[model samples]
Target chain A: MQKRISQREIARLANVRQETVSAVLNPNSRGNTRVSAESRERILRIAAEHNYRPNLQARILRGDSGSNLIGVLINARISQFFYDLLLPLEVELRKRHRRMIIGQLGNDAAEAESVLQNFIDYNLDGVIVLHHDISDGRRLFNHYLPLLPETVFLEVPPGVSGAAAVSIDFANGVREAVAHLAAGGRRRIALCMNDLRFLSMQMRLEGYRRGLEEAGRPFDESLIFIREPRPDYTFAELISDAVDLLAVRGKADAVIAGNDEWALALLREMNRRGLPVPGKVALVGYGNILNICRSTTPELTSIHHGMEELAAKLAAALEKPGTRFPPVLSHLVVRQSSI
Target chain B: MQKRISQREIARLANVRQETVSAVLNPNSRGNTRVSAESRERILRIAAEHNYRPNLQARILRGDSGSNLIGVLINARISQFFYDLLLPLEVELRKRHRRMIIGQLGNDAAEAESVLQNFIDYNLDGVIVLHHDISDGRRLFNHYLPLLPETVFLEVPPGVSGAAAVSIDFANGVREAVAHLAAGGRRRIALCMNDLRFLSMQMRLEGYRRGLEEAGRPFDESLIFIREPRPDYTFAELISDAVDLLAVRGKADAVIAGNDEWALALLREMNRRGLPVPGKVALVGYGNILNICRSTTPELTSIHHGMEELAAKLAAALEKPGTRFPPVLSHLVVRQSSI
Candidate 1:
């Protein structure tokens, strides 16, 4: 067995204080902790040479702990979007010397409650709830909300109270998407959404109406399609039915999907039905998932939801604690699907 | 505010010992602890009626904590496979009252080492390393392997020692795929793989050669295509080049992809080039990602890695520490693309 070198030895060898060694090794050490660059490099080099690795568990147990752990609560079903967001968020968190503990919330209220309980048990510094929804939303808001310690709700439902939030300006994206389609001479544009209960969806509906008004076009009730919230309602089937209702009967010339999955589903169904996209029925998607957008034959036009900016804001909020960050904005990314 | 009822209140009301009440609410409580069904139901119903929720945090802080925390470390990229596996594993873990903390490891060795350190700092009961790859494999084995506490490595690299592992037998899947193609009278079969450095890829290559030998066909080195590990290697371009190489030069009649993504990419490129699928170039993918396989035009033939079985095994291993579970087997799922 080899003898392990401690931070004390490294500090003595480098002619610096033990605190300087600690600050250099610590991930959460801020720039305010002044350590000369030459000393820092020398310490690091010596540590590397000696294969010095800190016993973080012993340090944490001894009460010399750094507040670097943050909990991220995500809805289990819609994890793909959250996962994409997490890739960047994790990198940013790493840069700041912070770590994330992810808790996947199942549809069952009890399970969701248990996850929240576990987060508290873990003694996380703060939490970020990504698309918060439990079976009983009222109970979550009324009882659980008060128990939450330094939390930030992302894409929060309407009328939820007493927490810092970083919400998406979905209406702004929807407006841009609608305006773009309308400018391309798409008069009778239809809207397809997954869930009407989500505040973002409601905002999109409002945006659709406003977009229509701006284009000097009347909003047709029949042109809108909202899928019933059921596990069996496949995205492809819902979009196929929506195409039949809007394109075949309602004579809609353009369509805007609630998200990229809906857009991809619409494209697949249209291709099956021999519908020429952009030539006859233009389509636009939300969430601007670049891979999915580019994968389609006629690359999908989508609303960019600024995931990087949102992640950065969430990280900032987590650090400051109790600070309410402004809502992240969205815009349009035009592609071949919507001309 | 309503008065919060404690477990003691429930126990007193239900005429049972506090230990019995503890056993009832504890997530990790095994079925061997015999409590009468009537007493169990009564305690549960009474607690529900009173809206009693366990204070897990206070319980943990009081040194009466159950070691139910499991840490899952995943490669920063290839998280989709791990995430899919996690969906089922989380459900299974919840049934046993265990919670998971995920640590994402980047390509950088230092970052990976740091994540491992954090996992230790958090005092996790056990750990699962999903597709473990630190830049220096030797350092991972030599230095970090000893530090892993009750860990199970999924799809472990070749020649790794001193850890319980559950590896997918990719060779069996590759052999099955190749034999199926051979039986369909496809003489010249090509194999496309990503990162030959992976033990699984090496196994697949061996399987390809063995499959060819079994079919009494000469092993052609020209039929194999391996891609360099680069971030920007898009699926479409990779498959497009593979198709050109095998179909044009090698004159291959069948192709087996390293994974489902590659298979789908090949299907797309072949479709664009107007090549008749099974009639001209039969294709098979690994990891039968059901949604992607079914989404393609002719559907896709793929290898079923048995994700559910694998997840179940992982959960069982986590429950009984130091027990090495048997390797999960893979088999072929013949879809339309392969005939």
Candidate 2:
């Protein structure tokens, strides 16, 4: 395969000044630099011949990205969690007179790279990376952070730095929920969660353990229910089994669900089996997605995610770069389900 | 507001060929046209002095919009319908090696106008208008269709011509649902729906009426339940009232809900009141959103919207303009709730 030619190499090959090559290629920089139309066409033809793809990062770094376009990087999944976070983010960006163009990350590293490259090519003024998969998120973020300086990560890993970010205190809300449940004289409190693949979910589990310890209760593995793949068992059936074990067969009197959806499922299963929520078994859910939380039978107790505050902080960080933002705290919103 | 300067006007002012002006302003055209750097700079400076915003429509029409960027126009609402449609659309676009950029339409015409204008400015190759509000949707479609020739409407009104469309046959599914309920010995069936502000919803209601006529039953006005705001009533309360009126007070033995969420709410209420879903009152819902539909105790019977097919058709229409697409059909998927 032939080596790809750079703009400098194109300039050398075309016998024109490097600045002239730059002017010919980047339309944004051509305002002041005057090159003959003949030279412009010649440079373009040569660059095309050599298959010289412009390094979007270099081009972006060279000029002002005053496009008033904010790129939002989100994984492609249809969840209420994404919708709740994005609605406020879009509203906030619109308020700031900025247009949001979503860059939906595909499942692989190549897809992530291509999307990031597109963002650079489009010359987006700022970017907000929201809850990407933990497997490659750290690698991608560490690699691309320097190239795209005006990036605000929604929830970065513990130590990564050098860019603006608005972290969420996911653990705090679970701790509070456990303590609240404990204070209400509920014993054998259980934590129902999804698979512990994501760093955020792992953090929640840690919080649950700490909460149990703080409540002077021994950390019991039996009380930790993780939803995973089981042959011939649908999600509903799994939830039913969990309900049977925790509220039906076992002596568990309280539970903290991973999310509002899980909490609703548990509530429905409990209701189906003739077990009363808050009477037989109390339940608390995370991510206070209002539509789901409000529609449930008992108007589910949930942890407020502070999506609006997080959005505001993200917009502010983008608007004024290098400004330190405090971590957005998650708090328990006690409702009928957990009383 | 200043009248926007056309490329021809700028060409006349600069004493250059209109082609030269076009080549200078649009980067894509510069590969063939050779204009001196001096003339290029002069033309740009003159255009700037006159506060000329290059009529993106004229530029896009004159040359090629080889920007493999497809713009999806959606209203700024957080709903599952949008998510379902968009996921498939994105996947199909990606399969075609095209990148998708979302243009979220705000509440007003001005906002829609701005979003559409932004799409043009970004030089998007094609656009897909997906279920904009009825009030401004028609007006906007008529206005922008000429400028953006490579456009497709998801559910265009009858008699809307001259553009490729991949509409869903929403009425057919409702007709099927009503017929299915009637065939199962359901008499005095009720239609539960949101406000008939949307043309699509109105079509569903029409199908309901037609279904009743076909089933040798009279359309009862009392059985048509529209969810609207009443003072001192929450959404849950309104749904509870609908359930009472349809199943308890009235002689309606079956009900077809507007959407899955509404159906779920009704089912929950019915369960709370100790009413068997299909035994006493057969139930049906629209938009077979699997996650929600499958989670309900007696899995929801719903109208399967062929969103994947719709998305594929939209993608095809955009890829090859002038290709006519048949309207995507919706069908009833009978589940535990309606059996």
Candidate 3:
């Protein structure tokens, strides 16, 4: 096998200091020092002849100020909502000349730890974690909190120390969704959630109860349905049972779903039972994932959770470290399903 | 700013060789050497005291055997189908203890070049390009073909040189879907596609024509709907126009959509027009995205394009370099929409 060449070899071949070679190669070092044009050309020629490229990883190991790499940690089971958030985030990062490396965290704490470890081992300049569960956040804080000064957590519960967070105001969003339904004379309102253990879902439940009380309607525990969170759990059976309990027995006139997935499943079950949307049982979904909303018959009305704004704010926070951002509010997008 | 400590400094502090320190730090280096338990403990203690972590990326640059990092290149606008593909791919990669970094390529050629450049700069062991357009592929092949020895292109056109590819047999899949629709007493079958420039869509068109000939029906040019690809083209108006052209004018009894997105749009239009699925106009969708298929009212009948199998095959090719893989086939998944 051929021996690989390095910047040291390039400096030896060009008969210049290694720092001179680095100054010629490093884009950030260009303005600081002046290498002779002839020596620079010789270094470049030697580098080209040996097919030598600067190892960014090595530069990072040398404690170079910037690696220009950002690590993004996302949940393993990402939805269209995350993709929507990521697109704009990538655009913003690209504008700053930063490349993103994504790590997927599974439901298991150990797997999430390994993913975070990989990010650290790679020496990423900063990290952005999206939608990590509260328990996972606590575990991560306990073990790796010191490494998170340059990290930002999105949609994490408030009061997490050692890292910045940008949480969605899900409570306000759910209140707006429920109030919209109530204003339309939907007295019997139900809340459908998946895994209330998540901090965001717990906030949604609180918002649901608050909206009902504000609307002068008693909170009905029987109307709230919580199911296990799994990709394979289509919620078909769960939503069917919910329809029986709310629409058939309790005469519920409206329901607020935790996310678009549950809302779509509820819509499917309603269609199966020949129930008229908005006329008989109005429905509202969270995370206004536009494609899923528009694809359904009588386009789903959903809470617009400010995913783009969140991405923009995250980019700003990342670009200017220690820049505090306020919690973004989620608003309602009234489409055909919720009148 | 506080100076960071390296493994060499830790080795110096612990009075051990740098190689011994490496062997202690690297998980892969443990089996080959026998460091005394006391020495190992002292070295580990010193390393911990100095807060030393090995830079895996630098090791890769130094021609170390493995960094266990895979870079996946995805299109900017990824759908649920892509996520379904990625879920299994990530699982398979993780089984081998390899972490994945994803880079998104935009429509602009320059932007795609920058993304591919980032992948090369990162020193990823391998790459997988999913569903990139032909022009982008050509640009990549022109500029970065030599860097793609361990790269695999998924669902890309044939004849791309210098890289392995795992292409979906869209022709066979479309043929199976159309035959199923025709077998159900549908003679005048129409084809709806977006962007004929894509090789996959072109193959779908051929399959549509072949299925019509197989069914002893002439291919009606009026029944084929080809629309330009756009992120915002909801296909509602396009499918509405197709419905008018096929059901109202051409008297087509069935339609084959290019993918699930278009098919769902068609279903929405049919539901709005009070047309019964399969009774009045049967619909078939390609790429059986599970969530979308199950979310619909009648449940979408779609072509199962073997996303899991594709991911498995790609992982196999990546795991064993130079392994040749045959083209995978797509099959019909019968559901209520077509039957």
Candidate 4:
């Protein structure tokens, strides 16, 4: 192992105070003008000779114990939803003079673990983990919780109690969406979801059952459409099959989708089948991705997951560690698709 | 500032070797079994008592110069394109046993500068700067190029020479699209772009002119449709106005858009006005974001930007620092919208 010269050693070699060495090195520092030009020059020369590099981690420990770096773990698959949460989180972090390092935790579990390990190795001041599923969240909590500093989970694992989290009340949002469809006198409502293995998908399913029971309608298992677990099968193919099951074969009057992307795709598929939305079949989607919802014909009706509010809560959790924030509630944004 | 207890200090306190202390501290270390249980217990006790935190930076400096951290600078505004590049880059980095820390350089210059500074402070091994525009790239180069280690520019600024870059040949793609339309007997071919201030957009405009000249057709300034610089106006509004200008007002027989998102929106806008795509106005788009191109009706014809190839080149640039990669050429994928 090669030994590197520290700021103290450099200061001693230059015959100047350690503070002078720090000021000369830090471009952002205002104290450089206070030091004599000759002293600054000497310190710079000695530091350059040894190829001195500032120890950011050591500086954090000695100065304030805050790295001012927040680690954000996100999955790139559900892009629009992830971006919604991330953009606002970045803004909120910037407001507190903090910078974010995003970890693209794709579908690979091993890759995801490495990303988490990297965060710990960096000794980040805080961590915000946006889970793809509850099981993944649980795995992270089991291994890395103690090692992580000031951790905030966007979707805390199901049974991991008392963790700092900012969660969406998807169950309630879907429930309201279904009830709205039911109140509109639509019978045989269909629910379209991707991968029921996900805790979020399970929550939405539960909400659908409750909404049906509340509306005095029977909860039929046949009415629920889950995406086929085939890698070659596109979301378009899934939507096409879903449109057939709901509108063509099953003759379902209303449908609720997992996200706006799926719902918009479904809308196009239904249009191809000559099924007029809100007339032949009413449609609703979760994650009111505004641009997507607006650009579609007869603009989509969606459940507005309050990403900005969730970001604020996520930031607040970091600020006041151990304070439990209530789950961020979602609201139904009625549009022509549901009218 | 309180002094941190190093591995040597812990070893001295436990009356054991520094290797023993290191084995006791590192969970991933395979050397733990060689150390005696008594020594291990003593080392652990001393480490815990002192609240010893591992200095990862020092470990990097001592053992390996590479931090194994690659900083990726990106703008979150053009999300689909950004994600297309980022997901592949993450995979490529993972393949090389390196981790990526994404810096979302969202529209704020101050924020972008701070992100670059953070990358330097962390002593990242390599950096991949995905420029939003040529001017922004130049600004980054002028300020941080000398300070950065092993930097790869995704889009090298117009004038800067001898920088490792993975750039898209938008001019060639647009030129091919224009020539294709011209050969198909389209009288008026219009070009729709966003922010002509971007060198990328200007390159496409130049290509459009070149294509017109090659086909013995006069270049018309009125045929170019640039997005209005109003913050309140939505992209949908721009697409709607563009449809009116190209199909109705100008009676253009063909159109080429900035991206798939814009082309998809334009297709829908044209559809809403009872104008059939390709039959009435042949449409082409750049950045063939596959999912979007697939889902849209008549399936948009677009120039595929080859993000995977770009990612490979970017990773290759980091591996061989001084090597320059050729500009990644885009190819047009014909679909129903263009035919």
lDDT of 1 by residue, B271-328 (tens): 7777778889999988887556765657789888787888888878866766867678
Kindly report which residue stretches of model 1 are placed more than 4 angstroms away from their true locations once superposed: A1-67, A229-240, A289-291, B1-67, B158-160, B183-185, B213-218, B229-241, B289-291, B319-322
lDDT of 2 at B71: 83
Worst 10 residues of 2 chain A by lDDT: A56-65
TM-score of 1: 0.78
Q: In model 1, how well does chain A match by TM-score?
A: 0.79
Docking class of 1: incorrect
Q: Per-residue lDDT for B24-139 in model 2, tens only?
A: 88766645778998999999999877655443333333454455678888764746688778767887887886777777776578888777766655556788888566457667
TM-score of chain A of each: 0.79, 0.74, 0.79, 0.77
- Candidate number of the best TM-score: 3
DockQ for the candidates, in order: 0.18, 0.07, 0.42, 0.28
Candidate 2 lDDT score relative to the true structure: 0.78
Give the clashing residue pairs of candidate 1, or none: none
**Best-first order by lDDT:** 4, 2, 1, 3
Better of 1 and 3 by DockQ: 3
CA lDDT, every prediction?
Answer: 0.77, 0.78, 0.76, 0.79
Task: Identify the CAPRI category of the predicted complex in candidate 2.
Answer: incorrect
Per-residue lDDT tens digits for candidate 4, residues A123-217, read 67788888645346566666567667788887777756445877777788888988999989889899998887667788888888888888889
DockQ of 1: 0.18
Clashing pairs in 2: A35-B37, A36-B37, A37-B35, A37-B36
Comparing 3 and 4 by TM-score, which wins? Answer: 3
lDDT at B308, model 4: 84
